[model samples]
Target: MQFFASLVRSVYAATILATTGYAPSFSGDTKHNAVGAAKAIESFHPESSFETFDVNGIDHPLSDRPEFSLEDAAVSFVQSRLNITSDAVAFRTGYANDVIQHAYIHQQINGITVANAVANVAFNKKNRVVSFGSSFVQPSSVPSNTPSISVTDAIAKAESQLAGEYNGHPTTLEFVAKEDGSVALAHVVQIQDDDQDMWVEAFVDAHTGDIVHLTDFGAHASASPVYRALPLREQNVTQGFRTIKNPQNKAASPIGWHNNGVTKTNNTSGNNVITYVRGKGGARYTTPQSSAPLIFNYMQDPTKNPNATRANVHAARVNAFYVVNTMHDIFYLYGFTERASNFQNTNFGKGGWGNDRVEVSVQDTRGKNNAFFYTPPDGQHGYMKVYLFNRSVPMRDGALENDLVVHETTHGITNRMTGGGTARCLQTLESKGLGEGWSDAVAEWTEWTNATITDWVFCPYLKRGGFRIYPYSTNSTTDPLKYSSLKTLTEEHRIGAVWGNILHNVYAALVSKHGFSATAKTDPKTKGGNTVFLHLLIDALALQPCNPTFPQARAAWIQADANRYGGANKCTLWKAFASRGLGIGAANRVDSKKVPAGC
Candidate 1:
C-alpha cells in the first residue's frame, strides 16, 4: 500500500555504486498478501472528504460495544474487515484533553515493524473507536530481515543523497514498505542543513544498499503548529529560540499550519497567514520550498557592534507566523467561525468567502517600537506589520514580543466579527478606542499565567517599565481608572486603556473565584474563569451593536453569558462588571459601581 509523502530521489549523472557488503535479498518469488482494504473503506464512506491517507476508513464509530483499548479493537478491525493478518501491534498511543485518544499500530514482519506500514485508530472520551486509517503493505514478496549492508554503511549511503549537517536527532533501522506493495529492510536517517532548512528523512534498502525512499520534511508539513519565541511572560534573558509545537484546535485549523486542504507550503505560508520578512536592503528570508523544521538558532556575537545583520530574521518570521496562526486557532474557539469571516485563504466549504488570509511583514520598517494591522472587509487580505524596536543594545523585534503580535492580530478578529465581516464598524472615535481596548485586553489575557495574578503591561520589553501609562491592575491606587476616564483622554491607546483595564479587573475577579487554566487558550472545552471571560469577550463582540459604548458592551457580555452558559455565570458577570463601574444603571460615561439589588 502507498504510505507517507511523495518520495524525492536524487539522480547523479554518473551511475552510483553501492557499498559492497553482504547481499541479503528478498525472496521475490513469494506471494504477498493482497486485499482491497483501502478501496473497501472508500466504498463504505463515500462522502467524507478525507485527508491524505494510505487507507482511511473513519469518522464513524467502529463498534457499538465499547472496548477497553483502541489498539486491540483496531487490530481486530483490520483483520476482519481490512483483510490483514494478526501481525499488527500497537506502535504508539496519544491522548488529548481527557476527550480524545489516538492509537498508532504498525504492521510487523517477523516481529520487526514496517515503519511505513502505519495504521491510526482514534476514539472519543466514550472509548468507542471513532476513526481508523491504515498503511499496511501487501508486498509481492517479503524481504529477509538479515541485512546485507551494516547499519553504519546504510547511514553513509542514505546521507549521500542529501545535503545537510546531521541534526543530532536519532537514526534507526526498520522495514520500509515500498511502492507496488513490496517490502524492504532499510536504515532511516534524519538530517538538516546549516540554515536549519531542508529537514530530510531518507530510507535506504538494507538488502541492495540502494536509497529506497526519501522524504523532504518541508514538503509534507506536519499536522500541528509549532512556534519558538520568548513567551509573553518571559523577559530579556535571551534564552534563544525554543522548538514548541503550539496546540492546534481541531475545529479551527484542521490541517495545522502551512496547508489549505489541496496543497501545502514549505515556507511560512498557510491557510490563516502568509509570513515573510521583506529583508529591506537584502534578500527576503523564510524557510525554503523544502520540508524543514522552521528552526533558528542564530546567536549574535558580542565582539561586533549591533546592527541589522545581528538580528535573527528567520526566527522573527517564524515567530510572527506562529503567533498569527495560534491567534487564529484560539479566537476561532470563541465564536470567530469561518462564517463570521475570519482570515483564511480557503474555508473548506465551511462558510464565508476565501482569499483573505493575513499577510505578515516581520521586522517591518514603517515604525519604531510598535506594530500595526490593516484590515479590509471579508474576502480581502489583512496586513500585519511588526517593526523593529531600536530601544535595546542589539535592537528587538516586535515579532518577538508576543503581546504586540497578539494585539495586532486582534484587529483582524474584532474588525471582521464586529459588523458581520464588514470591517467598518469600529471606525468611529468611540468604537476605535474600544477596538484598541479589545486588542490590549485580548493580549493581556493571552499573557496571563496561572502562577500569580499581577498587573499586565503592553509590550514591556521595549521599555524598562511598560508601554501603557499604567499597567492593568486591580488595586484602586495603582490604576485608578474609571469608565468616564475616556472622556478627557484624547488619544486612542489611553482612551482604550480605561476599557482594557476594566476588562482586566473583570478577568482577575473571575480567576479568583473559578481559578485559572493554562490550557484554556487553545482548548475551549477547558472550564475556568479565563475561559468564561474569553467566551464572553468574543461572544459579546457579536452580541453588541457596532460602535457600542461601555455600558452597551457590558450588557452584551451579560447576554452572551445567558446565551452560552444558560445564565450560570450571570451573577459573576454582574459582579465583575459592577466592580469595574459598569453596573446596571451606569451609562453615558458614568462609573456606577453597583450590581443588582440582591448582589
Candidate 2:
C-alpha cells in the first residue's frame, strides 16, 4: 500500500509538470547512420589520406590530409557521407595550435539536442582536414511530431524500469537515436540512488515507455601504525594528549599529541569539513572542549569500541580536514576557483557549481585495513573512507596516518581539478596513473612542508619504513622509475611510481636551486623553491588539456613556470623532466619498452 501511495505521489508530481504544455517533436527528414557516414568520409577527397580505427565496435575513418578547412571538411564530409542536414550539428568546443585545430560538434535534431552524441574534427597547420571521429547517431526516420503519452507517463515509465530505490527528475525531452538505427522521442531522466553513491541518466521512449539509453556517472576513489609517526602522530602535539596502553603489547600509546599549532573548534562541524564517529548514523560527534586538547585511548580495539578509538580517529579527521582545507586554500591563492572544480560546499555562486563537500568517513570498514577516495561530479559530495588496518596483522587505524590521509584527500582534489571538474576526463591509462602520482606528490609535499619526517616514504608505520616501490628521494638509484618502465607496469599504482618519481625530482631540483623556506608552505609569494613548485603544479593543472599525456603535462608545468616567473626556471624544469625520460620528443607510448633518450 505504501509503495502504491508513493508511486501515486510521484505520478501526481510528474503529471503536474505536463500541464505546462511542453511537447517533444522532430523536423529533419534526412538521417545519417555510422555506416553511411564512414563511406562519405572515405570518398570526401580521392587524394586525401585516411586511417581507420574500431572504437567501441564502430569503424571510424579519419582523414589525415591537411588540405581542407576544419569546419568545411567536417560539414562537407558529414553532409556527403552521413547525409545529415547542414544545420543539425552545432559547434560545441574547440582548441587550436600551430600544428592542429581540434573541434567538437554536437547533434541537434529539430530543436532538441541529443545527449553524448558528439563528433570530433581536427585540422592541421596547413589549414587542411587531418582527422575526424564521432559517436554521433544517424537516425533512420524522424519520430512522430507528437507523443501518445504525457510527460508524467514517461517519468513513471522510467521510474518503473529502475530496480533499486531511486529518485529522479525529467531533465529533457528529445529525440534519441537507438543502436538499431531507429530514432524515437524520449524523456531524459536523471536517476540517483538513495545513498547518493551512484547516478545515471536514463532515456525512456515517450511513446512506448521503453528504456533507450543510460549513462553512468559513478566515480570510485588508505594506513597504520606501530608507534613511529603514524597518521596524526607525524608531528608532536604538546597541547592535546591522551595516553592509552597499546592493544598488542600493552605499551602506552599517547593519542592526539600531534597538532599543527592551528586550533580547531571542538564542534564537529566547520566551514569546510565535518567529522563523524564511525557508524554514528552519520551524526556529527562533539569534540571535547578543553584546553588540554582531545585525546583517545590507544589500546582499545576500534572495531569493538569505536568510542574508545574516537579521540585518535577524530584527531586524524581534524588533521585531514586541515590538510585538505589548506591545499584548497593554497590552490585558491594560485587560481583554483569554485568554477575551476574545487572541493568546497557553499560557493555562494562564486565561480563553480555549489554544494561541493568532502565527507571524511573514519574507521569506515571496521577492520578492513584499507583506505580509498570516491569522487563524484562537481556539486556532488566527495567521500573518503579510512579503514582500520587488520589484514595479516592488526596495525593502527588508517585515520591516524597523516601521509595516508593527505594522500587520499589529494585524490579528491586532483579528480575534481582535472577533466574540467569531472572524474571522467582522467579515465585514460596514463591519466589514471598520473592521478595517483599527483596524490603521492601532494602527500610528499605536505610532509615536507610540515617538517614532520625526514624519510620521504608513505605509510612508514605500516610498512616499517615505506610501502612505495621506492622512497621519494632525489637519489637516482633509490628512485629508478623511467618512462620506459611504464611498458612493463600494467598496474595503476606501479605506473604511478614513474610519475611520482619524476615529480619528486622536480621538487628536489626546485628546492636545490631556490632553497626551502618553512614560511613558503603557507605563503604563495615566499619565493622558496617548494612554494614555487607548489604554485607551478597547481597552475599546471589549469593549463593542462583534457586527458593529457605525460609530454603535454610536462609542457603544462613549463608553461606554468613561464607564466609565473617569465621562464626563469625553464632550464631546471626541463632537466627534471629530461632526467625522468619525459624529455622533448619522448614517445607517448605507455606500452613500449624502449626508453626515450634524455635531453
Candidate 3:
C-alpha cells in the first residue's frame, strides 16, 4: 500500500554508511528474507535527476554545494537517490502508475543499472505534487497467496475494542500496509451524541493480521480532570506535616523559616492594589536541605475573596492554596513545601517558583526579574514568567488557572527530568504541552478508561459555556493578541494541539492493545503517571533534524519508533499521528544513527 511520503534516502554519504553499518558487501549469491531484501534494495536505489559525474571510483560525487537551485536540487536529489532517468523513454509510459505497488523501470544515460520503482505521488488542490510514497520493489514482496485484513476488518475490530456500538455514526476506515510487514488502520467516527468527534487508529501485523496496537482521541476521551477542593489552610497544614516544617503553623512556611532569617511577610498596599510577597530570602547559593520542599507561590487578586485584608494570616492562607493546587491537582509535584510568605515590593512575574519555593511579584510585569531568564550566569538560579494577559479585580483572567498552573508546574518537573540545563524552546514547549496533555489525559482516563465526560464540571474550560471544546478546532487563528508575533498561531498552539491529539490517540491505542501495563514500556519509573510519553517525545526529538518541518517531523517520529521500540510497537499511534496531517512515518526517511549526538 502507498504510505504518506516518498522513498528517498537523503543523508551525507559518510554518515549513512557509518550509521547503518553499511559494509557494501557485493555478495551476489547471497539469499535474504523477501521483506528484508526488498527493504535493502529500496534503501540502495539512487535518484536519476542529476548528471552522473564519474569521480575516481565513486560514480557520483556527494556535494554539499550542488550546481542547482533548491527546487531543482530537490528534484536532482530525488532522481539521484531513486536513480530515475530524465529521458521519458527511460520511464516506460506503459508502466506509469499511481500506487506504490506499480514499479517503473528506468535506465540512465551512463552505464548505471536500471531497476523497477514504485511511484505513489500525492497532489494538492492545484495538482502540484505534495508528497510521494516509497519506491515499491519489483516482484512485490507482498505474499500473493496469504489473505490480508481489509480496511473493513481492521475497522470492525477497532470499533469493537474502541468505538463500541454507536448508532448511525458515519465513520471511515482506511488502511495502509508497508513492505516491513506492518499495517496502519485509521477510523474517523462522527458523533451524534453530545460528545465531540473522535478518531481511532489501530496497527495490525501485516502477516498475521493480528491487531498490534490502537489509539482513540475525541471529545469523549479528551476531558480534563476534576479538581478536589482542599482548603488553603488545611492544604498548608498537610504540606507542613509532610516536610515537618513549622508544624505549629497549619500551613507550610517559606524557605529559611526556622533560621528566622527568612522574611515571614512583605505586604505593600497602594490606592486600589495590595501586593503579597513570599520567599524573599532563601539560600540561593546552597544545596536545598532534604527536609525543605519546593513550594509554589501563587499571586492572586485577593479582592475577589470575601475576607480580603492586609493581615499576615491572609497572605498565609493564599500560601496554602498554592500548596493545595500543587499536591492534590498536580501529581508531578511531590517535592516538599519549604515556605509561603509575602514579598514586600519584588515582582515575581504573574507567579512563579524557583528551586523548590514559589515567588509572587508586586509589580505588574514582575519587575523583569521573573521573566524568561536564558541560561543564567549563576548555575543555581534561573526562572520563567507566567504572565497573566488579562485579569479581573476579583480573579486573574486569561490566567493559567488551575489547569494552566498544573501545566506550567509540569514543565518544572520535566526540567528536573532532563537535568537543570537549558532545553530547546520547542522541546520545552512540546514536552510542556505533553505534560499538560498527560495530566488532562490521565484525568479523563481515570474517569473511565473508556467513558466520555458527561458533565460540564469535567471540562469547565472547554469553551465560554459548558459545551465541549472542539479538540481539532484551530482556535489560535481566532485569538491574535494572545500569542507572540514571532511565529504563526498554527506554529505555536495548533501545532501543539496536533501533538496533543497524537498523544491522546496513542494512549488510547496502548490501552486497547495492552491495557494500562503497556504504559510501563515508556514509563519505567512507574510513577503512577505515564513516562512513555516523555521517552517517545525525546526519541522523536533526538531523531529530528536541526531545522524540521511537518513532513520531516512525521519521519523523525517513525524513524525513532522503528529504532528504539521496534517498528512493530505502537503501530496504531504511528497511523493516528500520520492521519491528522502531522506527516507520516515515511516522511522521516533519514537514518537517525547519522544524526549528530547531544542535541
lDDT of each: 0.68, 0.59, 0.31
Predict model 1's lDDT versus the native.
Answer: 0.68
Best by TM-score: 1
User: What is the overall TM-score of model 3 with all chains considered together?
Assistant: 0.33
Query: Which candidate leads the pack in lDDT?
Result: 1
Encode model 2's per-residue lDDT on 1-599: one tens digit a residue: 01111223355433422331112321222222111111110101001112332232221223444444556556555443333556677676777877667777766777566564556666555444556555555455667747778767766665555532335453678766554455668777766553324466666777888766665555422001112123222421321333322111101101111211122233333334454555556565534422322222233333343334545655555545444554555556656667777665656456776565676777675546677888898888777787766542444556656667777877876777777788776778888788888888877876565322234777765555566788776676877778778878888888887888889888888888888778654456787788888888888887788777787888899999899999888888888887778776777543222223332
Query: Candidate 3: worst 10 consecutive residues by lDDT?
Result: 32-41
TM-score of 1: 0.63
Question: What is candidate 3's lDDT per residue for 1-599, written digit by digit as tens?
Answer: 22112325444433322322222221112122111011111212322121222222121222344442223333433355344333311333222235311223333222222222223322222223334333322221223323365545644554454334344445443233333332233333322222213343344333454443333333332111111222222211212222222221212221112121222212222111122332346211111222212232223333443124333223333333333233222232222111111111221232323332322222124432121212221122223233323223332321223333333333433333232223332354434434343334333432332312222111233223311133422233422221122134333344344444445555554445543432332134442223343345445544555335444445665676577568544455554454443322233222111222221
Tens-place lDDT digits, model 1, residues 131-221: 6655454456678778888878776765554535456567777776554446778777775663333566666788887766555566534
Q: Give the TM-score of each candidate.
A: 0.63, 0.52, 0.33
Give, for candidate 1, the lowest lDDT window spanning 10 residues. 38-47
